[model samples]
Structure formats: structure tokens, C-alpha cells
Target: MSEKIRSQFGCSKMMLPEHCSMLREQALAEYRAENNRFPETDEQLREEQQYILDEARAGGKTVIIKTLNSNGCNHYMGIPLRCDSTGNKIIIRTETGPDLSISAAEVVSLTIAD
Candidate 1:
């Protein structure tokens, strides 16, 4: 007998672990509303984040940092303020009007408001 063919399929690369287009759409809409536009779908936000990170460490640059929340449940975006050598950790002032320090290594998602 021939081997059975697979019926169900699965996705490989994804923006989120689980499919959450609704949540993603909501977030995108909010971003558009805030910046009057949307970020490029090239998924290059991480690069943008890195560029901003470098600028921040060098001093004086506005950046949006997507960092893991303290609750270990969700992510948040903020503008970096200061940093130490190698940019392992940075102090960022969030759009919500507060300062926070997030680890660069732990942060994989981020965006530049450009």
C-alpha cells in the first residue's frame, strides 16, 4: 500500500506565534493613527529597531522599542533614552509617558517611527 498523503497543512514563517490577524490589524491601525501611516510590511522592523538603538546609544535619536513587558505576557513600544556599552540594556521613555529599561538581547521586535 502507498503511504497516506498529508491532509492538513501548516504555516512556516509568521509575525506572531499563533495566528492573530485581528490583533495585528488592531495594532497596525493604532500605529497608523499615531503616525498617520503604517510601517513597511517587509518585516524589517527589527533592523529599524537596531538602527534606532545604535542612535540612542550614540545620544539623541527618537526610536520605538518593542520590548517584553514585566508581566511576561505582552510587548510594549517606547522611545529609548540612554544605554550602556554594546547596547545590552537601554533606558527608554515610552509613549505612555514613562521611562523603562529593556534588554536588547531579549527584545526581538521593534520599529522606527520614520
Candidate 2:
């Protein structure tokens, strides 16, 4: 037995203006949240940041590196293969792809994965 009143409204061709506006606002909010909209600091806090990275690399522990990029905040989880201060980058061995070399300038935070 099918109920005629229970029509599927998924992906309707038409949408109200209010609905469109609401969706636009929601998308903008999500973009800001994902990008870490906080003001960027001029100081990189290199010494403190490097200390955390060194600890993780020396212990051979998996770490989560949160980086801020033009697209947004990207998260990389893996064991660090190398930390090159002179080159201003760190290479990480991820399970799904080739080792990633992330610039120190883009790094927002680094934490050991539990």
C-alpha cells in the first residue's frame, strides 16, 4: 500500500529564495570554521613549534599536523620521516599516499596522536 501524500521531495528543481539564502549562509559559515578564521600572527613561534615536532619524530610516534592553507585547514596524520629546519619543511609518511612535505610556514598546530 503506497501513500500518495508521502511524495519524495528530494532534489526538487525549484527552491524558495529563503531556502537558497539559508543554504548560502550555512556554506559560508562552514567555510569560515574550516579555515580557522582567526587572525594570522606575524610570529611563527618557531622554537616552541619545533620542540613539539622533534619530540614526536624522536619518539617515532604518529602525529596530527593541522595546517592552514588557501583552501582551508588541512589535517595530516602520520609519522614524520624528516624535519628539515634549513628547508623549512617536514616530511611525513602517510598510509594512503606518498610522503608529504609540508612547509613550516603553513603549520598551525602539531600534536601526538592518541
Candidate 3:
């Protein structure tokens, strides 16, 4: 029922709810690959983020934080360095290059793996 409504909307730019809904699926796949399980709730996602932040502060962990691309799509990989004061930006160490600073609004998910 709801699945039909969701797939019907897809990622059309005009349908914000559909975009938001699909983001969950993206986050789920990332979470599963990183943790070997799917998050059961919003709290689980938050806990995962906190765990990544703590691990990042501790250093030497591979972290993948999803930030929206220029086209407003999400999928990225990097090491979390830290977030700036406004909470709207973060610095990340990229897989093949230098650090990158991206907007907090652009970040849709977090995945930390060994």
C-alpha cells in the first residue's frame, strides 16, 4: 500500500516526502554494509552517529558520511574529522584526496566501519 505510494513518487524534485522517504533506504544500505545489520529505529541511527563521532575523535576508523551531491543525491565516503561551530558544516578526510567541508543540511547518513 504505502510502498506503492512511495515507488510512485520516486525521486522527483517536487516531491519532498518521496525524497525523504527514499533517503531512508539509502541510509539502510549504508548502515547494513557498515554494521552488518539494519537500524531498527531513529534512535538506532542517532546512536550510530554518536558512535562514529566518538570513534572518529579516538582516530583511525573508516567513516562514511553521506552528504548530498550537487544534484541533491546522497552517497559519499570519508573519515569524519570534526564539525564546525554552527553544526551546519563538517570536515572529512576523503578516501583518495584531501579533506572536504560540506554543509550539515547536505549530510543524510553516517556509517563507520573497520
Evaluated at residue 30, the lDDT of candidate 3 is 86
Q: Per-residue CA lDDT of candidate 3, range 1-114, in tens?
A: 676577865534475778978999899888756654323436666666767767875786777766554454556577778878576676778889898887755556777765
* Model 3, runs deviating above 4 Å: 1-47
Give candidate 2 misplaced runs (Cα > 4 Å): 1-45
Say which candidate scores most in lDDT.
2
Q: List ranges where model 1 is wrong by over 4 Å.
A: 1-49, 56-62, 68-73
Instruction: Report every candidate's CA lDDT.
Output: 0.60, 0.81, 0.68
lDDT of 3 at 101: 82
Ranking by lDDT: 2, 3, 1
List pairs with backbone clashes in candidate 3.
88-104
- How many clashes (backbone atoms < 3 Å, residues ≥3 apart in a chain or on different chains) does model 2 have? 0
TM for candidate 2 is: 0.60
- Candidate 2 C-alpha lDDT tens digits along 9-85: 54344889999899999999998786666445444566766777788889988889888877777899998989887
Higher-TM-score candidate of 2 and 3: 2
Worst 10 residues of 2 by lDDT: 1-10
Clashes of each: 0, 0, 1
List TM-score per model, in order. Answer: 0.40, 0.60, 0.49
lDDT of 1 at 16: 65
